[model samples]
Target: MFKYRWVFIIVPFLMFLEGCRENFDYRDASGELLFSKDTVYLDTVFNSLSSSTYSFKVYNTSNDDIRIPSVYLKAGADSGFRLNVNGNSGQAFSDVEISANDSIFVFVESTFDLDTLSSPSFLATDAVVFGNIDTQQEVALVTLVRDAIFLFPQRENGITESLPIGVDENGEPVSIEGFVLQDDQLTFTNNRPYVIYGYAAVPAGKVLEIQEGSRVYFHEASGILVQQGASLHVLGSKSNDTEVMEKEVIFEGDRLEPEFSDIPGQWGTIWLAAGSTNNRLEHLTVKNAVIGLFAEGDPQLTPPKTTIVNSRFLNSANINILARNTSFYARNTIAGSAGQVSVFLAEGGNYELLHCTIANFWNQGPRSLPALLISNYTETSFGERSTSPLTKAQFTNNIISGNAGIEMLFDRDEQEAFNILFRNSILQFDTNNSDLLQNPLYDFTDGNIYEEILLNSDPEFVRDAPDPFQLSSSSPAINIGTADFISEAREDILGNLRDQTPDAGAYEFQGN
Candidate 1:
């Protein structure tokens, strides 16, 4: 009887070991389906016709070994788009294998048009709906588009060309490249989107002026870095603003979440290095940068000045403007949501904010993360004694709102200290409305120094104000400016004269 029982148990155990070595069970695969991007905006330049490229990764999430002979990509009910891989034919994809939790990526370049709206088609019809026996899956893509368009007017050079010039086999500018730009001052008559991949350096020895209504685009890890001693004059109006749009403009390669440090210093920064003095930036919008403008150079007694008038700094990881011994006269500038501090000055530099709006800095709580700090220190010696030899900043007449952690913190030591002068600025404590969580009027260490003059009320904004930051006629910021403190050529971001008695923060109320 004992011998018979052992034989039965041993035979079953041998059978179970054989089953464990077999292929993965088809019913056990379960992976979530997700799309690469949430929104896709179609610019009107292409006339409702567009094509983008993308890649898809399929993963197997089960304990058993699974097989995917072929994978099929289908968009919409009628199979509007398809992908062919390595000379294999299959409406149902195959030629694959997966062990428990393995995956595969399928690269696809799909073209779709919105010519028929009533019969409306999907931007990305159901991708990867067919084929594949096991494991839940997902699809992702890499979008592609044209970067630039050139337009030329009829001149003595006998040239007449428009935007969207067809490209030749080499993907170079076919029409505009040959036109000889004889005049030192030339105009690009084109009105289309021009994409910039790497550093788009303009011509040397001549000023490059972009007319209003011109749109420029930049790819990932790319930006416009004006070298030392260069000038860029951007002419834009509210109605027809000259736009510089960047899709994947990443300044530092270290901040892409879920996949940190994919490419360190993959792209250089927008360096407005020394000799970039007296350059004016007006009515421009800069987005998605590691550091918006990192200006550095030796200081002069009558220092070099860079003025940012009526421009915006949005969605950057580091300082919007990092000046080292460079003086900046920023007026009516709007800064929104910095991963670190909005403005960082170092080593005997000066910055003046007149009628400017700084919102949403250090939106994330300060816990080892970069807070919205204005410092006179370097990266290596941060939180330590101040090695920076500079006077305090002059933050006069500005509206600073929406900071999560420490709002405007100043750091320095006795021999190397920096102070803040908020003569007539409104520091609205609107973060969560819980006055306790809001940043203090002044966040200064025992050895630091600063000053502020807070009015007892919020400066009421006017109805449908031109800028959301404008002060109403009845607000407290009107007729409260200090003329002696501001710069002589100081102008608001809107090009308005800064002449309030005790200047209200960052704007000159129209009626007042």
Candidate 2:
């Protein structure tokens, strides 16, 4: 009987200790809640589209545990924003608990149709309010919404058809149906930015003209295709030379988020199909694409397949210009920052690049290819190899440099006619490598063919800053180009007049 009495007393004492541990202080008047940020800025999004989730932390600075009676958006359901408190999502959440000296996260996302709003371009703002406290803490939400013409592939029965490849040998249209721009849609103006979805094809015997100051934005895997007998003319003038950013035609990915601005392979290539002719791109900027330009042409045509002057192809995931058995002329063109070769001439044909810059300083990832690759033979996917005669491949007054030890590769077949000339050019070749030095293909002493070639010298490229690919005052490529080669296009890429003895690269060095 004495032991039973002691047991009952001990049991009651244990119960008292449990009660003290379970007791949590819930203070409503204390203002001890802190936030990670006062405002969270979402990336720029298109109307009627949903934005990625943004988050913030709500800290409990007080020593005691607190229960937020209500956490709601000030704009409520009418606002374009949505909030997720802790693990629950709603306009208003109840009893959000935060332990003492601990914190909880709150997520935010937005989806709104700008057409229903007052203006196409507007700032959407909302506030998250924490109630039940004498002093409430709020976090602001802000987003910039833009209105764009979203062009996507046509869907039939919830299935997107594939793009048409080309016509077969029988002249019958091949492949699946695709979005083709009509005659009336050939002209694109600067009234608004165009956002393409899948490939936008220009039909045969048609012409697609992009006016000056037009901005063409392509979605993932989207690009422009000029079919056989079709042409694409970008008519951007130099009237606003002082403001090149506003006057030049721009082609890039559709994502306006800051994180995706410089990402490559966001879009496909501007493919100029076989037999396509009379394509011209002037005073333009093409960036962040798989292949900036893929041109194939018929050697029978006397005129060049394409002419690109005073244009820039920057940050391509693959080759900037992949020419396969084509004839083209480029003057004052800048092709730089590519994952693979900057200018790849495969199964080579007639090609001339005057005062052009072909560089690949790709810091995004590992690059194993050279900046310039010229080959007279090509291997198919099935291992079938074929060789074509290289009629004329000239690089005059050009700068071919990159991070790779050997920035230029020439794969020529002895049986084929490989006529290549590098006149008054700056080439970044690996001179230390005995194999490269002994190779006759890269022999700088061949003055009969490779005349006035500057090898392995630093061009002093202004890589980081206001204008990249420009030559600094201490560049060795200054005043080294042949005057006759630069006379074709007297103006540089930046509209600066080239002197009688111009520089090697696309830009004329303004020495101090």
Candidate 3:
């Protein structure tokens, strides 16, 4: 009788505890619901495309735990917006509970079909109404809908569209989700932003031209591939005002959220493949790519048939440029922060970089490679090694630096020519290491190779300036560049004139 009595009391107590946890004595959420954001502004999304997920916090400021009677979108089921509350995604939620002084999250996203709407508006607006008319509390959701030229691969019977790049190491045909550009689509103008879902190839014998003020947005793993005999020309005229980049062409990831702005490795490279001829990129800005630009092999023996001027390649997750036995020329260009080498000229070829900055202050991860690397040989995966002559690696009025001692490396095959020169530049060649003293590569006193180089010195990129490439008044890179060889890029990246005594790097020290 005593044991049965104890069991009866215990069972009732357990039921009451369980009720308090799930169905507690909850008060109706009234005037005490605090919200993290009154308005949740989503990223600019293209027509018929879902946007980045945005979230807001809903807090219960009351002393007693409360339950909201209803949480729903104002338009009910007729809205394009979607909401998720407490792991449930729907148009409306009921009995949403929040602990006293605790908070819960509400996520919002949208995919608006502006093409089908009777009255398509640029700004899409909706509100999440909480409870009935008597206890109404709401938060506004705003989204910017943009009309873009959506270029994506098509789906066939079983396979999506693809482009043939080359043969793999196993001698199998290698292809990716991509498509070759048609004759009519050879030119990308400044009218609408281009949103590419896969690699867009410029077929052989076709020329792809990008006019000024055009924005090219890439989805994951998407890029531009200039095939052999195809040329890519980006013509961005200089702007009078330095504050705005209205005249420059931009290539970046499609995510327009502020948090994703500087994140690297969002897309693939703008690859200028082997035998591609006469490619030019001027007054352009490339951001957040696996590799900003890659030029491989020469169409002919003429070095510097491809050129980049007054351009900026920034925050590449991999090498900013990896040129394999290719001839290249760049002036007033910036190869900024990267996870690996900024400019890697492997299986080397002729290269000239005038008034360029290759600075890697990569804070993302461990960077084993140097800021600049020059190799005269390439070792294939099948244990085959081939050597190529590095005819010329000339750098004048350049700044090559990083956050390490050995930021420049030279790998020679002994028999190949490794012609190198640096004139009137700031180089980060820390000679403290014994290996540097013994190597012939760091012979800074040799006028035949290195002349007037501020070796192992600070460039004074302002006092802890956010942009490490920006020059301060006391920068050693200023008034040190030789203007003898400059022909077209007399104006820096900022449109500031590189005077007779030019400053190194892309910008010409516009001190206010």
Candidate 4:
């Protein structure tokens, strides 16, 4: 009798709970759907390149569960803007339901071909419609797209044309997706922005001259390879306005968005082949590359094969300037923010850096290397090593500072000729290392190498500025440079004349 009474009581309680449940049958309602933002700006992108995704919330604030029958783009089926309604990606979506007081995300992205943009940049706009007819609600979508010259390898018969770079370990031909630039094709003008898909190799005995104001953008793994007997002459003139870099020739990634402006390793590098010679860079700006300049070749010590004057290499992934058995004379140049090293002189090289700043504050990850590395040996993929004599490495009136305690590493092989000197420069050396202190390379008594060097001294660089290597007013680098470098780099990178007691690094510290 008790069991029967319990069973009757449980049945009534279950029926009572069912009566208080929410209504599961949702009805399609026609009403205004509120949005988190009225307009979604997807930032700027090059023509034919997709913009970053931007999202907005569609909130159903009313106490009624409704179905947005038609969530679509206003431009219909022929629109550049792509839409994703509640994780379903397409040009249009139907039956987008939202519960009461709940929200749904609508992601928007676009890639438009502005065959005839009125100006250099034009706005590409669209709207995401929520419903049909009188109950329509929308969030406008806009993006600025600029026209670019797209360059990629031509494909025929399922085989894409490629440029012959060198040989593999087995002496087989190694190539990259590119074409050998020769004759009239060598000259790159400022007519339009060039976007490179693969490595553009300069033919032997040819010259690839990039004219002033030319902007050359590289895609993934794309760069310029200077071959033997070839030259890369970047003849960019200084801008009249010192504040902005307008007239300089720029070589960077193809991304135009502001977020990728300073990010590193967007593309490959300006690779100088082992026998390439007579390369010059003036008033050039290279940023966001794996290696800004990977040079290995004739170490012309006297005249210096490669001259980098009034140029900047910023935010490189590996090494800003990696010279192996090559020679470089960088005057009034800045190489900073590298993952490995700002300037890596490996397998021997003749390097003369005057009035330059080499800093690597790699806040992106844990950097294990220094800002500068000078070595007399390099290894191959098979661990086979090769050696060369470091003829000379001179750093005058420069700054080498980074997050690493020892901002410079000198891996000198006693068998090879290792000659290096740092005069009138602020360094980040730690004298506490007994092994380094005892090494002849760090022997300060030999005035020939470590002359007038300010070890472990802070240059007091300007923080949160575009050029983080710029000297602050009360910097130890002020009025500490030697006058010997004036004949080589009289003017700073910005055309500021260095005085007798000039400040160190690329920028001359001007007192406020």
Candidate 5:
């Protein structure tokens, strides 16, 4: 009876333990980790160009840390494209440290040309793999295509190429005065190489006429610095414009701002040095410059009048006009984009604007900085000159728009010291914001009194889509203007003379 009771208790205990084990064991399995998105494949073809450029991006969307060791293009990794990871030679870019669920741009560019790179075939043939190690896991990214637009673990490479100018070899100077290219209009071909290092001091008595359709390319450090008693005759027309191109001029150096030494004239400024004066640039297109024109220092002694007519200054980093005491007569000019101001009134510069367009200028772009800019740097006292240091400029019949953020800033109570008279001008908003009709004009003394135009109506333009500055028929811009400060103005952008009353702004609607 005792043995029977013991056996019974032991059997019941074993049965209970067996039931609990089976209940917890449904199934056990292992799964592979998958990428959030599918791999990208491409067939990139670069035609007509000797070299090509490419960029990519990388993303991390996991809670665990992702470590990238290297990246490489399987096919001809060392031949077609070279890995410049953090500016070093490695298939893997950098040891990127991305917080969980964060991403960054990873760029790749080719060092050599891939003549027949265009289809998925190219990406497949040139497919690359990234090696990453995280928590002792060996992971491989096997791309599907021969050519691919792969976003990997790397930062975009901003490598620059330099133009060869006079350094090891002696350079030649084009006679600014007597220097005449056989063709009135010069074109840059593979041959006919001439570099103007330092300054292009003009020779006296001869007018250096640059005909319309003429092209002038500058080395990074190459520029024309007209000395006193010298002049430049830039002849261009609305139909045929003269081109002063910044040939491969970039503004990146080891220093804060680029110097002339690394790539001489890389800054690419058309500086009419203080002593240099009496220059003429008309119907010209000056683009991609550090400073379009810098007229600085010794205003009292510089040339009396400097004329810039019908010129387009596009995409400059700083002031288009850095004039001082220099009498400037500008007409039908366009200054915009990343430039400090269309014209910088520094060191007491005197200027007159007629039918000119100044808009979309400030510190913003790939080459940009964060700083509020003043429209004109008007000074009440520049040096010891007792002469009205801050002479008011006459901006008659001009279209100054899209620059609401910047104000006509004053220096030492100078906004009231002098005036920036805007007669028959239109302060309008850009298309980016349609409801707003004008710029936020202001004065230190006036405050909101002259803040902006309250019309709030569309200034129906001739063409409203792209360049909407042109006025339409039945528009308010016609014959609603002020009298001329110097001479009675004539000829609008359409070549129509001023009527009984001039238009409100730079353009008068001929169709209207």
Candidate 6:
């Protein structure tokens, strides 16, 4: 009788323990699954090019472990959209589980063929459908698909050779097997965008004239090379007041996705060979490249190697304007946000920047260089330095500022003549040191050399908005420029006329 009493007590305790376990609720509801985003827009992908993977999350807000009865693409197996639901890649998935208060990821990718479509450019769209008992939801997928003229290095006999770029640090000519533009291919109209696979070289005596509103996209390590005696003329006009998109010539990476828009070092440099001359750029925008402009001109030439006006260079990995033993003239130009120096005048050069802005606020990485660097000597591969004369380095009504303490570095060899002049410009150099302030390099006391310069004062820029380089209303640069400096062209970069006493830098100060 005692044993029977103990068994009954244990059975009751076991029943109580079973009742203490938590219960799960699996009722189907319309809003049971929460999505990270309602839509996913992929980049403008070329024909036959694989797109980058885009992902979204599906969260189970319900208290129970919810099992999605079906997850599939609305377009089914023949659709361009490929879906991977919780690690399983297929047209459809069944019984996809998400634990209570947990989430699962769904990745999508696509590869489109333009020949399959009836148009040159089209919008590819589909939908990711999720279903359960009496409930359904969807997330839209959209991508811009285009047919582009892809240029790549031709392979012969199973060997891919490159074109001759230039001299290396050892003073040796380096050659890579790249595609050389033929005489017929020199002119690029406002047709569909050209996607370059390797470096594109304009042969000697050829001219590559890009018309207005032409878009040129370069692949990784690909750029345009103006060979010796070749010319590059980019003729772009200011956008119409009523037009939504600017008519400026654009040079950027081939990737049109949002993530890679601001990424630097996407392509190589636009290199002007040693003897390349008569190159001009107007109303152009070059961004996300290794180097925006690399001009190596023959020092013997009298006229400027290249002339740029009303152009902008943004997000270069290294120097935006790298001129070596060259002559370049720029007006109403803005160049900045480089990994190293924004404008590097190395091995001596002749440069005149008028009403231009050279500022480097590169927050992408650790930048040790300045915004403007002028060096008369270049280090060779043998650790020896070769000195070149900096005939004329002039900055008038320009703004030279950056994150560095000293935004301008003038490394002059004692023997070589370093002729540099900063007139009516706002310089971001520390003047706290009495000795530095007194020095002619920092101070503009010498009438014949420097004059009317503002040192170490903030220009009060409008930082990282639509126009980051524009001067605010309270900027010290306003009404501080020499009226006679910009006498020829009364208009600033934005087509705004300068006042009697103009503001400095590329822009005229319109009220806040």
Q: In candidate 4, which residue pairs clash?
A: none
Measured over all alpha carbons after superposition, the RMSD of each candidate to the real structure, in angstroms, is: 12.7, 3.7, 2.8, 3.6, 14.6, 4.9
* Best by the TM-score measure: 3
Steric clash pairs (candidate 6) = 161-177, 162-176, 162-177, 162-178, 163-176, 163-177, 163-178
lDDT of each: 0.51, 0.85, 0.86, 0.86, 0.46, 0.86
Q: Which residue ranges in model 6 land beyond 4 Å of their true spot?
A: 1-34, 60-69, 94-102, 116-120, 132-136, 156-158, 166-173, 431-440
List, residue by residue over 276-337, the lDDT tens digit for candidate 2: 78999998899999999998866445678889999999899988889998888899998998
Clashes of each: 32, 0, 0, 0, 32, 7
Per-residue error (Å), model 6, residue 254:
2.4
Model 5 local distance difference test score: 0.46
Q: Candidate 6's residue-wise lDDT over 320-385, tens digit each? A: 889998999999999988999899998887888899999999999899888999888987668898
Positional deviation of 195 in candidate 2, in angstroms?
A: 1.4
Q: Which stretch of 10 consecutive residues in model 4 shows the poorest summed lDDT?
A: 20-29
Is 2 or 3 the stronger prediction by lDDT?
A: 3
TM-scores, in order shown? 0.54, 0.90, 0.92, 0.90, 0.48, 0.87
Better of 5 and 6 by TM-score: 6
RMSD of 3: 2.8
Q: How many pairs of residues in model 3 come into backbone collision?
A: 0
lDDT, residue 353, model 6: 87
Pairwise lDDT winner, candidates 1 and 2: 2
Q: Over the full model, what C-alpha lDDT does candidate 6 score relative to the true structure?
A: 0.86
Model 6, position 483: C-alpha lDDT score: 82
Writing each residue's lDDT as its tens digit, candidate 4 over 1-512 gives 99999999999998877665434545575766788999998887888888888899999888877788888899998889998888899998888889878999988889887776766568888999888787888889888887777767788999988887779988999888887765867888886788998888888888899999999999988999898888899999886575855778999998777888878999999998877778899999999999999998788646777999999998998889988888989888988888888999999978888998988888998898899999998778999878899988999899999877899889977789999989999989875889888888877668988888888888888967776777888899998899975777787887777899988899997676
Residue-wise lDDT of candidate 3 within 420-450, one digit each (tens)?
Answer: 9999899997757787678887888889999
Q: What are the runs in model 5 whose C-alpha is more than 4 Å off? A: 1-207, 240-267, 297-304, 361-388, 403-406, 412-420, 427-468, 472-476, 483-488, 493-498
Instruction: Write down the worst ten-residue block by lDDT for model 3.
Output: 112-121
